[model samples]
Each structure stands twice: as structure tokens, then as C-alpha cells.
Target chain A: MARSQSQTVSLADVADAAGVSAQTVSRVVRGSDSVRPETRDKVRAAMDDLGYRPSFAGRSLKAGRYSSIGLVMLNITDTGNMLRLEGITSAAAAEDHAITLMEMAPGETLSLTEASRRMSALPVDGMIFNLNRMVPDFREFKPLPGLDTVIITMLEHPTCSTVDNDQMGCSEMIVSHLLEHGHANVHFISGPELSISGAQREEGYYEALASRGIPAPEVLRGDWTADSGYEAGARLAADPTCTAIYASNDAMAYGVAVAMHDAGKRIPEDVSLVGVDDSLGLFVPHNGLTTVRFDNRQVGLWAFRKVTGTHDMPRGRQHVLIPGTLVKRGTVAAPPSR
Target chain B: MARSQSQTVSLADVADAAGVSAQTVSRVVRGSDSVRPETRDKVRAAMDDLGYRPSFAGRSLKAGRYSSIGLVMLNITDTGNMLRLEGITSAAAAEDHAITLMEMAPGETLSLTEASRRMSALPVDGMIFNLNRMVPDFREFKPLPGLDTVIITMLEHPTCSTVDNDQMGCSEMIVSHLLEHGHANVHFISGPELSISGAQREEGYYEALASRGIPAPEVLRGDWTADSGYEAGARLAADPTCTAIYASNDAMAYGVAVAMHDAGKRIPEDVSLVGVDDSLGLFVPHNGLTTVRFDNRQVGLWAFRKVTGTHDMPRGRQHVLIPGTLVKRGTVAAPPSR
Candidate 1:
């Protein structure tokens, strides 16, 4: 099948067919509102007759702007990633700009050379990198000479702007809340050690305990999956002193809850659970599992704004950290008497 | 900031600077591996010195093909939508094609005219419309002259190819399972009335009941939310005769589970519950809510293939329906004796 018969058709050909100037044909092709309805109809009919198709590439070459943003994400399947994309898309739509999305293969780390290659090929005015994996050092990560770039990561870059949630603060808040509830100590279920956010949260957990003169206990590691959380919870459930548990994410916390239930330990009455990310609120509803909520969408929005130079803040490598709110629910309670 | 200094650099200029022919410059720009290492370095240095950046748009115009696909989604926030996007992106990346994403504003429907406009402006050879709402008449929905298009919906368009899960079959399987479990009649918590998938599922529910010579009971409406399912579950809980419930989606099914718990009804004992879309499996592991699972990712991958004309099928409008599998977890059981 013929994909496009208009490959050879030019603006001059359309203009000649429509009995108009090339500029008039160009205006019609660009969907300019200034063209008269009758004139536009005549030009469209001429285009159809000549098999002329307008191309966004031609328009971009002429206007020097693509009116679109490129988004580099590790994956869109994660709940946090989806919410961030929603925010970015909403902002782009409001600005009348389109979004070009690119996802890295699972377990793929984006290198500086690959990033530069993608930026050069992408027909976008700016790009937002939402990859959670470790990024190339900002000093060495030079984007295409002219493309504006922003990264969503826990670490601040010296050149590229950054946006992230306050991961450390979220953990500190969870630990303090558990401590304030009079628990002797809060056992931790940490996320993967390689994750930047996970490392920050773990640091905060230790810092919060240190500030209160409580020695840190052993940390159970989880790969941010519910099953991993379940395994960790089983170990915690076997220890009577583990009355309070903190999982790095909501999925893991739900797993811990299930493990506790299977062990015949009632929530709050026997054990208190808290997690980061209030993602399970939709499924669990009124059964509150105390957790920290981050507006990842806001992070996305700010990243877009920074990349596009649309934000009110001073330009040049700005770092914006969105704070997480601690949601108190039914999970935390005073420790049971020994 | 100056966006692109290479706007004025031409291929001829780069060739002159590199002391090579225009063809050689073009070959280097395309990242062809045929050039000698020393020659490639010379060309690269020339390109950098002349501020010559390779543009995908320029390459597309020259090759008469855009190595990109346009994905039009209603929203990416939904769990199903995100999964479909993951599948599409994975397929696209594997094929070395970029994805340009466009999202419709909430409450906004895509009219044929609007669709035609988007198709014209998009620099993509093909487009996949992942909108769940009602579409225009297939006869009137003409895409830009030769641009390939695919729609993901319950209904089929004579002109545009389509890929969808068997929504009706999913519901039928749910009803059949409940009936086989010895329930008198199944009560349905349906999705929004205007949703195409919702309508098809509801029809299947009725058809399955009719086939079994069982009259359809009162239908409880839900907007595909857990809260709406909770409301419906409360009404069903008040009537002890209503022992079996089928929620159109898993979110509502989870809500129903919560309501049953509140009412002190043991799952599969006091009430047998089934839901479509095993989405809650991530959060509520092992506590089986017997649900139907559709491979939405497969639907998305097939839709991408159809739109790009890459699938090994006939070169006309074709419909592909992915089947759903009934996963009997822990929620279904024999109805109690009246």
C-alpha cells in the first residue's frame, strides 16, 4: 500500500494548483486561522488534488521550535512514574505542547553518550529525564549543545536542573512518628541498596534514631516488592520485640501487614506498621497504614517547568525538593505492656 | 538562551569543513559504521566546529519515513492505561522507534475532525488511539490520506484496525463461574454507563444469565471506583439472598471486599465475590478475590503492530481480541442454603 503519495509534492506545486502564492499555501498548511474559509477550502482541495501533505518537520525547520518536550523514563509501569507522567502531560497540554516519551529497557542504565545521542535525535525543545537509576555525573553529561534538560533524581546536578521528593525527610518523619507513639524502637524494612532514594531514606532512619539516642537495629532489605516485604515481615513477626515496623514503600507495608495477620498478630494491638508512598490507599481504604505521601506529579510539573524555562525561579541548575506529608492512620499505637 | 546554533549549518558546509563529499557527511550524520575511524573523527570534529547537529526530522524527510509512532491516550493515570503504555513503549524500543505521546484533556472526547487534525500535525507514520470512550462512525473517520491508524476499543471500525480484550467474554466467565458455584443469581456492580468496555461487560452479564435461564437481578452502578463498589456492596449486604457479586473491575471488587468485612460477612461463605481485572493482586495477595485477568499489554503490543502494518496479517482493517483467563483465587464458594 502507498503510505504517502505526496512525497514529491511541494508548497509551490500546491500554490500553483490553488492559484495562490507559496506563502498562502504555507499558511494554509500550518493551520493558521488568518486564512479565509473559502480560500482555505480552495487550498485544501488543491492540496488533495496534488497529493500534497503538510509535514511537522518542515514546520519545525521554518519556525525553529518543535513545541514539544521529550520525556526519558525508566519505565511507566511503576505507580510513581505514572503519576509523574500524568503531571507532566497535564502541564504540557495546558501549555499547548506535545510530549515525546522514551523509556529505557528494564535494568538499563543510561550513559552520557546515549543521553547525548537521544537528545540529538529527539525533535523536542527540551527534555525531562525521570530515570530512577544512577545518572551520569553532571560534569560529564553534556546534552546536545542547545537542548534544555532537567533530571528527576535525588542527587543535585551541577549543570542540569533537578527535581525530587524529600526522601530523607519522609523517613525521618516516619521514624519520629513511631517513636512519638512510645515504641521502644522501630524496625526498618529498607529498599534496594543501590537506589538513590532508598539510600537517602535509610540515612534518615539512622539519623532519626541517633538524634533520639536510640541505637540502630539490623535493617531488613527488600527490593521494593510486596513479596520481599512479606519475607522481611515474617522475620520481624518471629521477634517479640519488633512491635513497630517501617517499610520503605506501601506495597512492602501491605505485605508486612499480611504476614503479621498470618502470624495471628493484630495490627496496632500487637504491631504497628508504616510505609512510604500511600499507593495502597485505593485498595485497602479505611484500614489505615500510616505512610508518607509524596506529590510525584508536582515533581514532574516542576521538572517540566524547569526544562522549559517556564518557572518563576531563577534559572541555571535549580534544585526543587517536594516535601512529603506523613498521613497518620490506624496502624500506630502505644506498645503493649510486657 | 540560544536554543540551536546549528540552525544555519548545512550538510554542504559540514562536508566542506570535513574535506569530504556531501554523501560522506550524510553517512556520518546517520551514524553509519562504514566510515574509517580516522575519517569519522575528522567528520565529527568538523561537525562540532561548524555547529552542525543531526536532526531526525531532516533524516525523516530524506528517507521518506519517520521512525516514530504516535500514541494517543485518554489518560495514563489508570492502571490498565499504564500497562498498555508499558507494552507499547517496550515494543517501540525493541523496534528502535520513538513514541510521541498525546493525551486528551479529562472530559474531552476525540472527534473525527480533531483526530484528523492531530494525525496531520503528528510527525509519525502511524498512530494508536487508546481511548475507552465511544468513537465516531468508522465510515466517517478518515485518517490523513495514507497515515495508518489503529483504535483500541470494544467496537470495530470498518476502516481502522482495532485491538481489544474480550470484555464481554470476561464478564460471561465471571457469571458462569459464580453460577457453577451454586449461587441462585449473581448481582453485578458495573462500570460507568458511557464506557464502551463497561457496556460490553454489562451485556455479557445479561447474556450469561439469560443463557442459564436465570433472570437478571438489580444492577448496582459504579464509576469504576472502589468507593462506588463499597456503596453497591452495602446494598447487597443488607439483602442476605444476594450471595454472589461480580464487580466490573477490581477496584470496586476491593471496595466490596472491604464492605463485606465491615458487615461481618465471610468471603465465599456469606458472600461469593468475583471481579474483573486482577489489579488488586499486587496489594491483596493470597486472599483471593477470584478475578478475570486480561493481557492488556498484549492488546497494546498488537495495536502497535497493526498501526505500523508490521503484523503478519491481511492489509486491511482487521480486529484482534485477546481472551481473558478466569483466575479462581479464594473468593468463590457454594452459596449458603436459604
Candidate 2:
């Protein structure tokens, strides 16, 4: 049975039971400096007997700061995104700050007003927004008043603090390395159409080929999954002109590798491959797929520092890039002699 | 430059500018029915001019309930855990309850008192604890007073509402299916030792073996990673006696599959394989691996319903188990004739 209203413990009831005034009970509950130790203990015991629960909302209202930060993301299931979150959480822990994660539904975009309402309602000193995709409408990305926010995306906004990967540079390195291997006809399996990294990498591919006087080959778009890569690979395998393939990410590269294997083409023997963002390195050390590597953790750490630092001393907008490196595993080789 | 004290907005400033009492300003900020439309508009405009930001903490203290719910987890990187979380967030959204995610450091455990204190400090109506591992000390698992709590683990505790998958039943189905296919000996790749689901599944495996009058074979342990599974597979590949293997989860199974492939062992033709969970289905079609499938989404949805329902009704403890089904694919087959 539910407890009756009279049985519900209140500050006045605790005061009456402890033989103290309501103001004294309130001071005890709030842990005020003026309460005597003996009186505090007596009040606390009386409150415990009556099951008096102090509201965190009240205490946090008085404290004004929770020493916590909110990380708002569209999705956490993505490995790259999750790794970045791991970096942020680890860095936040080092700084004695806790993380409050808010995730959007799959493929759902929240309106600016809703986002503002949620951020305002959160008991966090600052917030970090990890928008994997570009906001179509500029106004939708506006910040909530009084909340310090940092954006983590591939794009650099003029009026916000951002920590992101050098995608254009990373893409250029991948394309240059592939071209240096004498692969004139390099087919590209790009990420989803709306992806900022995809567009940058595609531009890099075109720039490399154009600089070398090689015409841009057909580009197959993938939805950042291995299955999409495999489908693209199947289409490329039928074309002998596609002697090499550059996949946007490692998962897609793995899919392409599988498709090539099923099509009776051996890696580095019949077709060479390259990929970006080597999260696959975690599960498979001898994966033998060449790819670009970057410290996503550093990006996250930098973002945390920027958000928390700005929370203390509000600063002007700044943009920082965490660079990428080429990890040459055995997946790259000179184009097969045809 | 940081905003000065004079620039910092307060409720009193809004009240004074609007020519209303502090209580009226508070009501307007809280969107209370007591505030007339004209007064609310005046207060809101005054707040805008004075840049007064309403304190969610203060408003929540007066309301005695925060619309948000806390989801406390040990790790958010695990795919299964993340999928379950996806289920929870989706369900919570439908019910208009926002979620605040609290993740413990990777592989870190907090004491009961610490966990209680953290939950108490959060402005959440209730909390869901998704502890993947079983607590060694019973006292450590005790629920916090005055906070409605739900657990998402296989253990059936007396004081908590729990939503869990039937691990033992799922394991039994996998073992029974493999044995029915005329495999005389089935090696097992078990999950981490401390995992509650892992322990339950191992027990089911032994139960199936004993029921068939077959002695239990050597059980290889993995830390629930594909890399660990690869190491285990490498060890088992050398043992010709090992014909069939049941991996604890799909990622580990995928690793074993890769190891066997590298070792020139044909799946089903040389060694039959089975895995638990079908997260791989997310990426691949026609995966050719036989396994058990359960709606982790359902477990998450059920947990959210239980938590929110209890929040309203303030009910007693309830235990729920979502069952699993065996998905027949090509991976399981009769052992190759010597």
C-alpha cells in the first residue's frame, strides 16, 4: 500500500519530531554552517526515521554548478563516434567532470527550439555538440543562451569553437599514396552523399587525378557500411579498368576486400585497396588493409578542454584540427600489370 | 571578456523590471497555471531584456520530479549494450521522458554508496542500472532509498525490478541445435568470467552436454572481443579434435571465423560454427552462420516501461525475461567424416 500523506515526511514534521523550529530543520537539511553538530545529528536522525529525502534539484539550485558536462550526439552506435566519446569521457574524468550523454533517435534531426529547451534543462556547466552531418539550415545550429557549446565536426564554423579531423588533408594523402603506386585508374567508393568527409575525400581524389592528367573515373556512393562497399566492389569487379579501389573507411574496405575475394581477385595481386579511419585496427591487427590513421581521442580531448576552459573564461571562437597519418599496411601495391 | 556580475542576470532583476513579485516571476519561468497570460508575457519579455536564465534546478526542486530519467551503465561502447540503449532511448522518447546517460569508466565499478550519491545528485525521476557484470558482494547491489531503480541483468534480485534476456534458455537452444546435427564434440568459446549472462550460458552448455551423456570438452575463455576470439580460434585450429565451436557472441564468432579462414579451414566442411546474437546481421546478408536471436530492443523497451510505470505507480519488484529464437543458417552442419 502507498504511504499516507500524513506519513510522508516533511521539513515541518522533522522539526516537530526533533523539537526544533522549521527554520532550524531547513538549515539542517541544507547543511548550513550555523547548525550545531549535536543538533544537526539529532535532526538528521529524526529525518532518517521519517524517510525524509532531500531534493537534489533544491541543492543544485543553491550550488549553481553541477561540475558536469553534457555531450549531445545524433548517435552513439557508430564506432568512430563512440571512440570520440570515449576520449571525451576519459578527458572529462581526468578533469573531475562527469558526462551527461543525450542521443537523438536514428536518422532524427531535432529542431533548434527543442535542442535549446533540452540543453537549458540539463544541469551541466557546459555542452559539447557532435554533429556528424552538416546542418542544412544555419539558424537550426544556433546556441542556447548562457550555455557554452563546442562543435565536433569536419566543417569549421566561423563563430564556434571546433575540434575536428583534417579530412581534406587525410583524403589528399590517401589519393597521393594510391597514385604514387602507379594506379592511374583508381575507383572511389565514397561515403554517404551528405557526408562532409565524403565530399572532401572525393575532391581530393579528383584533385590527384586532375593534377596527373588522368580523367576522373566513376564514383560509387556508399552509406558508410561494409555492405555498401561490397555492393560497390561487385560493380567494380566487373570492370577491369578498376585496377584499384579507395574506400572511405576501413569497414567499407573490409567489405570490398571480401567482395574481391569472392570474385576470385587476390589483394595486391589483382586489385589494390586503400581506406580511411582505421578503427578496424582494434579487432584485427593482421588485417593487412592499408589506411589512414588519426588520433580521434586527441580530437575528443581537445574538445573537452576547449568546452570546459571556455566555460571558465568565455573566449572567442577557435578552430583546431587533429591531423591524420598514413598507416601503410600491406594493402597497397603497384597496379597489377595488365 | 567574461560577463561581469552586473551583467549576470537574476530572477529578482526580471521581477523588478516586470513590476511583479518574485513568486510571479518564478511561476512565469516555471510555466505555472497560476500566472495569468498578461503577467507571463510581461515576465518573459522582462527576462529577455534582462537576460535572465531560468534555473532548471530551482524549478525541478519546486516540482518534486524531473521529467528526465537516468540510465547508468558501465560501458557504452559495446554493440549489444548500445543496441539495448537504442531501444531504451526510443521507448523513452515515445513516452516523452528524456534520458540522461551515466557511463562508468571502462571496466570500473563504483561502490553502492557512491552510486547512490551520484543518482541522488541527478535531477531524474528514476534510474535504470545496466550492470553487465554480477556484483561479488550482495550488499553492494542494494538499492538506494527514495529512488525508484530498475536493473537490466539476468540476476533475479529480491528488491529490484529487472528486465533480462533468458541467457540459459538461449544457450540451451544453441547447444541442442549443434548436437542435433550429429556433431559428436562441440567446443565452447565462453565469454568473460565475471559476466552474469556468460556464467548462465556456460551452465546451459554444460547442462546440454550432461543430458546427452557426453563429457564436457575444454572451454576456452574470451574477454568478449573479436581479438580474444581470434586468439582462441588460433589455439583451437591446431587441435584437430575440435570440430564444432560455439562462440559466446557474434563479434568473437566473426573473429573465430576469420582465424579459421586464415588457417585454410572450410566452415561446416572442416569445422562447424555457431554464434550467439545477430548483430552481424546489421552489416551482412547471407552471413551463413547459425545462431540464436533475441530482441535486445525488446529488453530495452521493457526496461523503460517498467521504470516509467513504477515511477508513476510506485510499485513492487518485478522480474521479466525476454526469450530467444534459433535462426537456422548454413554454418551448422554434420561433422566431416574422417
TM-score of each: 0.90, 0.85
Q: Each candidate's DockQ score against the native complex?
A: 0.45, 0.39
Clashing pairs in 1: none
Native-vs-model 1 lDDT?
A: 0.83
lDDT of 2 by residue, B1-338 (tens): 22223334678877898999898987887679987898899888888777676676866766777777788777666666877887887787677676776666665565544565566566677788887865554345655555667889888877888888888888778888888888887899999998888888899888888988999889999977888988898888898988889998877787788788778887877888888887663222245678888778888888888878834634778888899888888788788899
Regions of candidate 1 where Cα sits further than 4 Å from its true position: A1-10, A28-53, A107-109, A135-139, A282-287, B1-10, B31-41, B44-52, B107-109, B135-139, B282-287, B336-338
The alpha-carbon RMSD values of the candidates against the true structure, listed in the order shown, are 3.7, 4.6
lDDT of 1 by residue, B1-338 (tens): 23346355778888997899989988888789999989989988888787776766777766767778888877788888888898898888878788888877776666755855665576788888887777554457766656788888878777788889999889889998888888989999999988888999999999999998999989999999888988898889998789999999888988888888788888878899998888764434366778999998898888877777675757888888899999988989999886
Model 2 pairs in collision: none
DockQ of 2: 0.39
Question: Local error of candidate 2 at B226, Å?
Answer: 3.4
